[model samples]
Target: MKKVVKFGGSSLANAEQFKKVGNIIRSEEDRRYVIPSAPGRRFSSDTKVTDMLYDCYHQAESGKDFSGTLSNIRERYDEIIRGLDLDLNLDDEFRTIAENFKNKAGIDYAASRGEYLNGRVMAAYLGYEFVDAAEVVAFDENGNFDDRRTDKIMGAKLDSIERAVIPGFYGAKPDGSIKTFSRGGSDITGSLVAKAVHADLYENWTDVSGFLMADPRIINDPVTISTITYREMRELSYMGATVLHEDAVFPLRKEGIPINVRNTNKPEDPGTMVVESTCNKPKFTITGIGGKKGFASITIEKAMMNAEVGFGRKVLEVFEDSGMTFEHTPSGIDTFSVFVNQHEFEPHEQQIIAGLHRNVHPDMIELESDLALIAVVGRGMRRTRGTAGRIFSALAHAHVNVKMIDQGSSELNIIIGVENRDFETAIKAIYDIFVVSQL
Candidate 1:
């Protein structure tokens, strides 16, 4: 029953938070492997250690006296060390960092120090061996993660150690240069470790208890999804539900390992279980409501357009030539609409419009902006009837107009487009019908 536990920055923000994490890990005997992120904000207005390190490195890059900035970062760790009442001395570590900073050791190196230092503290406190992520997690020269090499090396390394703390986020390239995952990448690191060890479960501890059915900002106290499939999670994450890193699902999902999204603040709560598939039924018709705004739709109408063999391909090529990607393309007998990010398309709008006129001559071209796309995703919806009817009814009752609606052939999700201003209202209406009213 080996489990890989990854704690978010908030779980390791300060000494108090660290103590809570320590207790959580000690409580579970099978939680042998640990991954820790840099200290996050102690409070709302406080800065994250990673952000502080980035700022300090930027100052050093500009050839400024960054000693003061570096000292502040040291104090953050010193405060944690004192709170934990550990006999660890970080002065030597700070000296090495200072020398590296003087040598302009890239921003990745500076940012990774947060996890490195925290891993040291975590290892000492838990009486576990400290395994630097750089030594095991491998990234190619081009900064692409080498999953095959990483799994082999990391697995062998952990096989030899009973208990160990592996810092999350940045890994080392072939030349040992530091390379970081994108922001919020510690989640990916944890998934990789889980795959390496073939752990029964991967536990991700964060500030929130788990993924909410709807955005908390839109729907107050929305229900938590007890279990969600990786496919369902991908749909929600693509739209905007961001409890877990979007890329984190790949590794564990491929290996058939389940991920438990738990809360470090409230370990008693089971949170959400993300698995490949589950027989358990969802509590609601729709598993989750997630959406994003700022999209524009381009409608092109042409006579006998459907009769043209390569009409759609020719139309899409214009967008591709302009370096633009279409989000959705819903077509009719003589009309088709292309949805895209408004901000990205704005700069290349005229070019795309001109290209469309040149390649696929149309009777008229219409453009609509400030649109939002919402995804109502759930496996339960497939087994239930009138799901789309319920969504339309809910939106209609709320006086929201749906500009477009598209359901995937799999019937796993229904995407609805609405005016940007109606985004929150639409999500609320949908939530009320499927979740709140049920309660």
Candidate 2:
């Protein structure tokens, strides 16, 4: 039962957090492979090591002295080492990094040092082999991640090692230059490693115990999602739920490796399980609620619009020509509405209106701005009746008006459009009806 366990930055923030992570790992023999992110904030006011590294790198590039910043980074590692009672010294590592910084080794290389150094400390503390991500994770010369290449090499390398720690978030390009993934990329790294090893499960440890039914900022102490399928997760993630990096699921999707979004601090709590498909019914009719704000809808009306050939294409082409991608398009026999980012559409509104008049020649054009889209996603929703009615009932009771409603044929999710002012209230209402009321 091979398992790849990846710890987030907060899980290894300081000595205490590191000790907790160490105990979690040592408690499970199946956790044979490990991944570590950079040191995060120890407290709310504390700056992350990665941010400090970026600042130091910028200073060096601008021809300013960076000794103090580099020293502070070195101290963070020293503090962890001291707290862990390890005999390891990172003086040489610091010196090499300083020299590279002086040479302007690029921001990617500098930012990657946090994870690199933390992996070093974690390996020494756990007595496991340290595998540098640059040696395993692969990227192309263009700095794009090379998944197939990563899989081929990582699979061959990890096959022989019984236990090892690989730093997350960064890798090397074909020319051997450092390239880091975007922020929150450690999740992607963990996903890739799990796929390469074909592990039974990929455990992602973060500060949260599991995925919440709604954003906590909107709903107070939202119910935790016990189980969610890949499709439902993608739908919620696309709408703005951020418990996990949205792209992290791709690598494991084909390999059928389920990911466990666990909490480092609350190890006993059974966190959310994300699977490809599940027969296990969810506790609530809706598995999750997620949404986004700042949208504008362009509504066009013409008699017998559905009977017109190439009408939909013509409408979308106008948006495509303006370089504005529409988020959703709800239509009827005589009318159509295209949703796009308000900021993107505001400038091109006049031009798009003119173009639409010239192309489709609709009777009237109407525009509404400051819209928000909320997605109530769940696989069990397919079997449940009146899901949309309940959502409407809940929102109506909260005095939140729904401007638009769209649902895919799969019946897995319902997309509701509301005013920006009602975004939070809409989410709370949906959560209350589906989860809170059930409890």
Candidate 3:
């Protein structure tokens, strides 16, 4: 019945949030191991503690006096300590960090202090043992995460400790140098620890209650997804859902551990359950809709293209040679199109187009910009027939012309391309047919 619980930056932003987290941890006996991120924004306009650390490091690296920046960061923790009324003295730790900053510690070391400091305070408040991630987590000399060593060491460390708070985000290199994962890496550490200990569930506490069926800005209070399979989650995440860190799911998914995406502010609310598989039918037709903009499509046409054996390969090689990856390639008998993000082609636009003309030599090449991709993801859709047909029909009713379509081999997700201007309208149309029409 063990559970690996992770609290995001917002959940640990201030003392009040800390109290709530302590209560949640204390209430569950099996919640022995905890992973915490740096203090997040207290309000919409506030900067995060991690961001401040990065700024401080930048000031130091640029040879600018960062005493003021360092003090501000110290003040943030001081305020939290004063509010929590903790007896632990953080002066020594603060001083040590200040010294490190003066010595110009790398950005990774500086960024990691956020989680390290927060974990210290949380452990003191909850009367739990504090385990430094650097001691248990390991990276090879090449700076790659040594998953095998990390899993073995972390498993042994947690095996002996009954209750502990482990800082997230950064681990130690083989020579003991500090290294960090990409942003929001606390999610990765939490999942790794969960798999190491073989927890029954991993709870990711964040600001949002759960994943919404569509972007709230586009669709008002879109239905919250109660349960989603890992395959479905991958699709939605790839398209643009920000509910959970998609990469964090791998470790837990391999071990068959379900993750509960919960809201720290609203602990009473059942957020979302991300599982390996389920036969449960969704209350709504579409589980979620997400999309991204800023795409460009290159339409190439050639006579008897279907008869040419290597037509597609010849067309894609131009992209590979020009150092670009194709997002989607939907083809017809005599015409084929390759879709890619516009931003990726910023510097090499003309070269790529010219190479395509020289290598593939199509009759004509048309470049269209301002495109968007939308995904309708749901496990239920795979079982219920005509899900794709219904989605297309809804878009047709809304007069939204879908430019391209691609579905994964799993059939858990269907992706459609449309003009950037119609992204919101297309999402609304799909939501109305799948969610509102029933209501």
Model number with the top TM-score = 1
Q: What lDDT does the true structure give each of the candidates?
A: 0.95, 0.93, 0.89
**Predictions: Cα RMSD each:** 0.9, 1.3, 1.3
For candidate 1, the TM-score is: 0.99
lDDT head-to-head 2 vs 3, winner: 2
Tens-digit per-residue lDDT, 150-261, candidate 3: 9999999999888889999999998887899889999999999998888999999999888888899999888788999887888888888877888898998899999999
Residue 46, model 2: lDDT of 97
Model 2 lDDT per residue over 354-435, tens place: 9999999999999999999999999888888888899889999999999999999999989999999999988888888888
Candidate ranking (lDDT, best to worst): 1, 2, 3
Cα error of candidate 1 at position 198, Å: 0.5
Number of clashes recorded per candidate: 0, 0, 0
Q: Is candidate 1 or candidate 3 better by TM-score?
A: 1
Kindly list the per-residue Cα lDDT of model 1 for residues 168-239, writing each as its tens digit.
998999999999998889999999999999999999999998889999898888899999999999999999
Tell me how candidate 2 scores on lDDT.
Answer: 0.93
Return the top candidate by lDDT.
1
Candidate 3's C-alpha runs over 4 A off are none
In TM-score terms, candidate 3 sits at 0.97
